[model samples]
Structures are given as structure tokens and as C-alpha cells.
Target chain A: MSRVRICRVGESQFAAALLPREAAMPEGLSTRSGRRDAARFAVYRNNVGVGLTRALERRYPVTLRLVGEDFFRAMAREYVALAPPTSPVMLAYGSQFPEFVENFPPAAGIAYLADVARLEDAMASAFHAADEACLAMDALMAIPPDQLGDVRLTAHPAARLVSSPHPVGTIYARHGQDAVSPVTHWCAETVLVTRPHIRCEMQVLPVEEAGFAAALFSDEALGPAAEQAASRGGFDFGRALLRLVSAGAFSAAVNSAEKEARHA
Target chain B: MSIAFSKRGPRLGFFEVHAENYMGEGGLPHHQLRSIAERYPLSLHGVGLSIGGEGDLDRDHLKRLRRLVERYRPASFSEHLAWSTHESAFFNDLLPLPYTPETLERVARHVAEAQDILGVRMLLENPSTYLVFEESTIDEIDFLAAVSNRTGCGLLLDVNNVVVSSINHRLDPFAYVDRFPLDKVGEIHLAGYDEVTDEAGERLLIDAHASEILPDVFDLYRHTLRRFGPLPTLIEWDNDVPEFPLLFAEAERVTAALQEAWRLQPEAAARRSAA
Candidate 1:
């Protein structure tokens, strides 16, 4: 019964449930004339399903480009059936799709298909994320060095920290473009996509930098967050901080009472 | 096509944001809408608020929507004259509804309720459906007119959609011009649709808005202008978006149409001759 409800409008459930299965439906759920109602419902079901599938295809272009139209549409059809868009704004739909592609049977051949979706999802979120005035260095500098450890800085509203076991950014980049590149990692990648202006552009970062940003986003103070990143080998702590600051990755400077007095 | 706004600093167009995108757990979407609110007027276009639902209205959704309108002070607000309901479930597309009295009264009540809460008039756009219900008792033109008369809501005539619905249903598009209440129209939409053939070679015009406006759609807009007078017109090219220059050029086409209409308005022409 739950499964039938999940099929939505495009689903021809009543047509599927012909004479052999006539007696099973609960009252108010399916009718004796179920096929007629279901057929009429399918028109909208198909339309809604098609619209959402198209939105997903737009979001994950690289995945689509690599798989070709027929294969991708088939996958999109399945994905749509599984994760239908409940929201009317097409832009915000398909957040769960990347994870779905990872387990989808036909897509088993493409091991990193899920990660490609992750990058695309993050990019969409970043593109539509709110605009904020990034915190300034001068203000941060004013705080006493000792007090900096206690104050937690807020990450930029548009910045997203994504961590994956598979190299999603590399797959998205390679598949998203007209040309393919060998540099894409089969291993995991950590990425940051920030919409400083109108468009959100993706940048893959070293694990340490990604971890640092993620920590800051969780309200961890700068000093300890840098320490966590510093623990990652080959992490240039100073350069990483500079890159984040330049990108407007921090929205506001959080100050403890001591830190506030120091700045004063 | 030539169209123009009544007065201009930045013009009256708002970022026609989908209502669902901003339903956030307190995040950037709300923040951006607030920031943009300062520079430009916004239109809270409801895509998920199924106004035509048989079920009780989603109060949770309405509460969030009310909060946004209260905070933003948007210039205009709108939703579709369609049901996105699938049985008791909901879909993301603007699902069509039969124009019965029950549906009409329900939609009007919802529109009226929405306006009362938001403390402003609302615009309800007609949807483009691939199929029609046999149970439909009222014509769509009459249905819309009745809603306008009942709720005092404005009309957002999406001309491309009018053409799409007309061609898909094999009806006359210009007839919509006659039935649509011109006095109630507040805004106009001009968008592009894709022309494709189904597997059986049957013609289908989908309101995809992926590219440029078609010539026939432009003609419909001209008729709208002729009937309604020059209103706030927008050229939407959201998908497969070209450069800003191209969009600006499309806006110029609307500007031209409006300029022609302004010149043609009899009183204005007389004043211009006097000057």
C-alpha cells in the first residue's frame, strides 16, 4: 500500500493492478475503476517525473555527459521514482540523488558516480546560498593573539565543505567539461565551492584545507582548527588560511569577552 | 517585441524565486533574499503551496511563506491556478485541475487568505497542461475571470504558456485576450518554448523556457499589450542562459513594444503633438 502511494502520478499502479489482484486495496485508496483514475493521474505523474528528472540531469551534467543521453535518462527515471521532487523550485531538488546513484544497480560499473553528484549538489547549494559580507582581516588582527584561541569564527554562508571517500570533484570536472583529464583522482577528495558573486565556482582543496574549513564551519576557533589541519602532512597552514580568507570563506568574527576587550 | 515599464530606475522586475528554494532551516537562501530585497523588488512565486489541493492547506508551508512576505515586503506575490496534487500526494510541477465550482471557491478562498495574511494583493498564473479533465464544467477563461472577480487578485499572464496551452489543446490563443480581465493584470511574462514531435510525429510545444522567444508568442504578447495597455513585462530566459547582454537585448524588445503603445495611446499622442 505504501509502495503504491510512493509511485506518484506517473505510476500506472491501477493499470498494473488488474483483475488478478483486484481485492487487496484498502478502502479510499484504490477504486474498482482504479485503472481509469490511474491513467488520468499518469499524465501528471509523467509530467512531474519528467520535470524533476530534467532538473537532476541539469544539476549533474558531468554524470549525464559521460553516460550519454539514453543511459542517463534511464538512470534519471529510476532516480526520479526513488527521490521525487516535493519542492516546486527545481533548483533545490535532487540533494539525495548522488547517494542514490552510488547504490543504483546499473551504475555499479561507474564506481565514482555518487561523488560526481555530490560536487554538483554542493555547487547548486553554494550558488543559491545567501550573500554575506565576509569578515575582515583587520578586525581579526585587532583581537589579542591569546584571545583568538577562544573565539569561534563563522564560515561564509555560501561556502560548503564536502568530504567524500571517492574523488567526486575530479569526476565532476572531467565529466562536466567537453574534454576528459587523467589527473582526476580515483581516491577521495575534499572540496570547497563558494559563490562570492553571482555564480558558484568549485575548487578542490587539499584534505587539510577542507578539514580546516569544515572545522571552522562547525564553530571551532581558528587556532585549534589550524592545529587539526597542521596534523595533515604536506598542509601549508599559512597558505591555506590565506586562501580561505581571500575567498571570503568567513562571514563573521566571533569574539569571547576577553577577545572583545582586547580588540577594544 | 517592443514593451516598456511605466517608470524606471532599475525597472520593476523581481527575481521570480521559487517559494520552495528559500524554505530553509535558517540559512543563506533567506539571507540572500533579504540582501537582494534592498536592491530589487521580489516576487514570492509559490511552487509547492498546492492551493488547489483537496486536502487541508499545508499550514507549515503557509507559516514559512507568511514569514518571508512579512520580512521581505515583496512588491508582488503569486501562485499557479493549477493543482500539483497526485491522488493525495504532491509533485513539483504545476498539475492542472478541473474548473469546477468547488475548485474555484477553494482557490479563491486560498488566494484571499494568502492576501489577507501577506497584507497585499496576489497574482495567480494559469498553468499549461498536456491533458484536460472531462469533469471540467467551466472554461479556463471563465474560471480565471471568476477567481479574479471573487478574490480581487491580479493576473500574471505568462504569454508563452498561453501559446503552449493553446497549441497543445488545439484552441485559439487570441481568444484568451478577450476573456482575460485586463483591468486585473499586473505583470506579463514572455518566455521561449521548445517545439518537438512525439514518437508518432504529433506536434508538441513544451514551455521549456530554454531558449529565445518564438514569433507567434511575441504576437500574443502584442495582443496582450493592445488589450491590457502597457504593464510590467519581463523577458525570462533562465535555462541555457546566454550572456547578460542577450537578456538585456530581449528586455529592449519589450521596451520597444511599450514605447510604440505609449505613442499610440490617444491622449499621449495628442499631448506629444501639443508639446
Candidate 2:
């Protein structure tokens, strides 16, 4: 038989056997002595499992700390087996881990773990998102006051808003420490993640401003977004706009007249 | 290390990075890489191309690699001879393949395609294997030589991998080096291996790359340098990486070995002067 045909036949089996923790050794593999060595095959198995688990650990350090290392490792291994990375870019791996944690039975009790994972994922995304120039605060000031309402602001590529029912921002900030401070306020929180410069910055948005920020992110004009924020009662449109602009949430500000002129 | 390289850490030979790590659209990775490239030479080493897979190459991945190559124009570009992906699932580890004429044809075609797309010659690295396939008809070194000869691609002579695989397969490391195509070697890699016992009560070496190079691996590296002359050498410590100072110390050892190798071979010096 042609060795090529045999290789084509055995490679899929070889790949299938390496994934599952309880998989049997694929046939036709042997040591130099020609023995079907399970221990020898286990090296590849260990490499795949350990390599992916370490990748998850690096991505979700906060989640690892939330649950101690042992539990986290076990959870990571299970996740790896279930959803081994589809992409070779290890940095892009584990994008679906937050959802996996949410549906996981053992982790269901910790309602905040999934949100924490989500925050970390957003932070990572922002860190690696396209490098676009942030809209200077002066650009917004340069607009005529009357034309401001018709201005549509473009969200920065690196800007991400993560809203959770749990106090996830506080949990994420308390990471990398031995003791996590108790969250005195147990309510919903919205976080804005942006990399205006080299550092990734996160801020908790006031509950009233979440709607406004969401509207702005979705490309709503200033007038409507501010109106949406005002409908929430006691919403300060000027203060919210200034805060987001200063945070480098938007990349560009174009007035309706300029947009129409460009179209013409 | 990216930070250290950017901040002008101990100046050494060229710096290499995994191509996949910098495949993101834009970010700190690109920024840091740009800074490093401006200062020193960069090598684009890919770990996820899956060049030896039985299936067709990933076009999207090849495109991304092309974009990276176009942007950086690195001093060298290379990938492993082993495969890492099968179908849609990427194993994230360099999986082994059987060496046969059919597999050889597929790999050479893949390498030629990659070179066509990348618009640059690539060096293919030998892998450290624990088990051998029953269907493999070609020796590992011969398979590498055939691929290089067929595709016109260079080889990356990893001395530590020679030590690891030779011991695992019960072959002599020096003999394996003697048989390697030194003329095609564009680069060298030295790393540490983890030793374990196999089921048949034999010693198995795992290319863990988590610590310093072993004494025996260093000896083989010296032997390789004596035969092949000095080349651009890299010390890989991907996992359990120590501080920059310690990694630089390892690079210093490679430097010392390279200088000694250059002194020992007068023809190699003459060849360099003639070039």
C-alpha cells in the first residue's frame, strides 16, 4: 500500500484521538521499539491540553482568581475539550469562554463570574483592536452649538461597552490582589472600555448614561441620544457627552451639513 | 520580551516572534513590533500555518501572513514542518505526520504555494517527535532534505530538537546532524527539553522549551556549528520564561559558541570574506 494513502487515512484518526481525555490511542503509532506506547502518545495529549489551558488562564486571570487555580484549571480543561480552538491564533482563542462559564453548572452559583469574564474579554479586545486616532475634545468644541445636535459621532474601533447585571467593573479592578474587597453596592453596572492611548482604560458609567452611551455607540445623532438619556430623568446630556469625549470613546465627529456636502 | 526589545535591551542578533500573535488588526502588538523592527532585524516565525496537513492550506491564514510579511518585510520568515490543524479544529500544537512520497508532494506544494503567496523564501523547521508512524517510508532527515530540494525552501536546523528526537527515537544526534542539509540551513534554534519515561521503559524527551539548554544539546549545537558554520541562532523559551537578563544570558552562550565555531573553521571565515 502507498504510504501516502495510509497517512491520509490515519491522520484524521490521529487528530481525533488527541483531543478527548479518555480517547484510545490511534492505531499504527509506535515507539522506536515498535510497541504501541500509550505513554508516548500521551505526550501529544498532554501538550494539547496543557497548552490550551494555559492560554485560557492568561486570558482570564480574573476568572481564575475568582475561582481558585485548581477549580479553574479543571474548568479550563473541560472547556478546552468541548471547544478546542477553531483558529490557530491563540491570542484570539477563548472568545466564547464567557458564555461557556455562564452555562456551566458548577459556576452557575457565581452569577458574577461570567460578567467578569466578559469584562476581561472586552479589555483584551480593546487592547488588540485597530489603532485608530481618537477624536480630540477640541473637535467637539469646534462645532457650532446649533449644529451640535445634528452631529453624528463615530465610535472608536477600540471602544467597547459591557453592561452586566453584576458589579463587574469593581470586580475587574480588584484583580491581581490577594484580597478582593467586598462590593458594597450590589446593583447593575455598565463599563466603557477604551484604549485612547497605549493603556486600556475602563470606567463605570452611571445608570442613566448607559442608554445615552448605547445610543451613541449605535450611531445615533447627538440630539436623539441626549433625548434618550433625558427620558431617563435627571440625565445631564452635556456632562455625559463631555465625559465620553474625554474618555476617547468616539473617533470622529461630523456634522450633518458636512456629511451632506461630502455626499454631494 | 517585546517590551525589552522595544526599550533597547541587551543588543543581540535578530528577534523572532510568532506570526499569529501579531495577526490582530491593529494594536499594541503592531505598535511594539514596529518599534522593534525599526531598531533591529525581525524574523516572522509562524506556528499555525499547518504546512504538513493532509488537506489544503488555510487561504485566510495565508492572506493574513501575507499582510504581515508585506507590512514588516521581516529579515526571515519560517514555519514548522509539522501540521497543527485538521479540518476546522486547530489543535494549537505542532502535530506530527507520516513521511511518504504522497505527503512529501503535498508539503512541497504547500511550501511552494506559501512562498508564492508570501513572495519570499521560507525556512521549514524540523519537529521533535515522541512516536514514529508505521506508514512512514522516509527517514526524518531525508524527508526534510527532499522537501527542501523539491520546494527550493531553506531549513531551520534546531539543535535541541535533534537532541530531543534522536534520544526519543534511539538515534544518534551527531549522525542526524551529519546527514542534515547544512547548505539549506538559514537559521538555528536551541531550547531545553523535558525528559520522561515511556511505557516501554525508555527515555522520552519532550520539547518543552521551558528552561535552559542542556549540556548534551549544547555539545550537538557546537558540533552543528563546526560542520555548518555560524548562522543566525535563536534561543526559544516560550513557557515559564524568566527575566530578560536570564534569556540574554542564554543568548550570550550562543554568541560564545558562534564565535568559537567561526574561529575553528578557516574555510568558513574565508567563505564569509569572499561573500
Top-lDDT structure, candidate number: 2
Name the candidate that leads on TM-score.
Answer: 2
Tell me what fraction of the real C-alpha contacts between chains A and B each candidate also makes.
Answer: 0.21, 0.83
Error of 1 at B253 (Å): 4.4
* Cα error of candidate 1 at position B141, Å: 2.4
Q: What is the TM-score of chain B alone in each candidate?
A: 0.86, 0.95
Q: How does each model score on lDDT?
A: 0.71, 0.90
Displacement of residue B18 (Cα, Å) in model 1 is 5.0
Instruction: Provide the RMSD of all predictions against the true structure, rounded to 1 decimal.
Output: 7.4, 2.9
| Candidate 1 structure lDDT | 0.71
Q: Which candidate leads the pack in DockQ?
A: 2
Alpha-carbon runs more than 4 Å astray in model 2 = A1-9, A261-264, B1-9, B272-275
Number of clashing residue pairs in every model? Answer: 11, 0
